[model samples]
Target: MGVLVWNELSRYVSLTASAYAVWASFWGMFFRKFFWDFVGGILRNPGGIQCVHISPISWAFVLMSRRPSPRARVFITVIVKVPFIQIMTTIVGFFILALEWPLRPVKGTRFHRSIPLRIFLLAFQAILALLFYQGTNASLWSLIAAVFYIRALTLGESIGPWKEQRGTVGQV
Candidate 1:
């Protein structure tokens, strides 16, 4: 009975991880399209705007006001709501990056981004996924989850250097 519960839990965990990996992959791949431009807009034009108001009700109204067909209007609405989401996401990202070499000072390599450290994070996640497997019952689900996670990580890594030049928010 204990073994049954453990395997069941493992299966659930694997499924959740797979879902997370897919979510991460989408965010990682389309971050620029979904977020960077909006965030870039905020940072570049900080001009005396000390506070931001995020109104979900207003956003819902905006969405309802549209004909619900044009991609451009949907994109604009998303952009309008993005700054709030960006704040939370950026905070999480900062916390994660802060644990690494370039962000936080450690024993070695003070000046450069640590490739080995990044690789180690990926490896650790893979090992974690392997640990989720529970003998013959669990099968390849854990491994598949790990693969997805690793791909998401790599896709995330592809979005390098978040800075945009001053006063160039919407320029091509």
Candidate 2:
């Protein structure tokens, strides 16, 4: 029974990791698009006032309203549209996704689990999305990515020890 549960848990973890990676990559693409567009716009018109309200939401609107440069378009296409790059990104992202799970809590203590490091990381990522992407969609997607990552981590923690124990028992 334990072995069966462990096998199911492993499958679940792999699926979850792949899904999280794909989702994160989607947000990453959004972030890249907005960031490149903002850079291209600023480079084209350095002194132009981008926003009237000067708030985060306003800035996002302003960025969304701008036209992307040809260079920016090509860059986005190469990174996001190219088939090979997409596959490689998904592969790399899976590992990146897997790594984030262990950072949330320590192995054996309740106090260590009190503070989730992923929340701080999420905040930092949100700030980057706000500053560079400056788009509502990008921010929202990043938030979703954070939520999915947290869920994946929580599920992994709940199931991981069972798998390890099952492995040891089989070895014995």
Candidate 3:
């Protein structure tokens, strides 16, 4: 029963994460504004700017920007919301959701964590994603999804020190 509950919870986490990737990728600045409004209370702390646990893609922005200031956050926050980036993210999110459906049964198991299996799943999904999204912007987006999805699955959901928001989609 505990295992069943754990699997269900992981499934919800996967669903929420995939939805967030789609919404954040598609909505652009509107999603940022919505995010700020929802988390406004937390950002109000005078001591330090709070780092939001968000999409792994957003963390890439943070690392690439490489500045430890609020300006970096502002820049990343805005950049990530760009329509092009958002659309790509949405595409990747869709792929994640599609792949996730099959993973529901094995979630939270060591079998799910096996490197060989992960490679196989990623290869299968990437091929399908490439074919599914071909002749469109998603062609490039599939590459991005391949990297992020593998990292998300292999490294765990925490992109860095920030929190991993499993429910960002539902909240937004």
- Could you estimate the TM-score for every candidate? 0.23, 0.30, 0.31
Between candidates 1 and 2, the lDDT winner: 2
Off by over 4 Å in 2: 1-99, 103-115, 134-138, 145-163, 168-172
Name the candidate that leads on lDDT.
2
lDDT of 2 by residue, 1-172 (tens): 3433432343344345445445554555554433454454532233332422245654543332344467666544654344333344455444334443433444444422322444344434444434323233434544555565465566554323312234554576
- What does candidate 1's lDDT look like per residue over 134-155, in tens digits? 1112223434433444454554
- On residues 43-127, what C-alpha lDDT tens digit does candidate 3 reach at each position? 2223233444446765542311122345445533433333343454566566556545545555545554443443444344333
Model 1: lowest-lDDT 10 consecutive positions? 130-139
If both were scored by lDDT, which would come out higher, candidate 2 or candidate 3? 2
Candidate number with the higher TM-score (1 or 3): 3
Give residue 62's error in model 3 in angstroms: 29
Q: Residue 99 CA error for candidate 1 (Å)? A: 8.0
State the lDDT at 164 in candidate 2. Answer: 24
- TM-score quality measure for candidate 2: 0.30
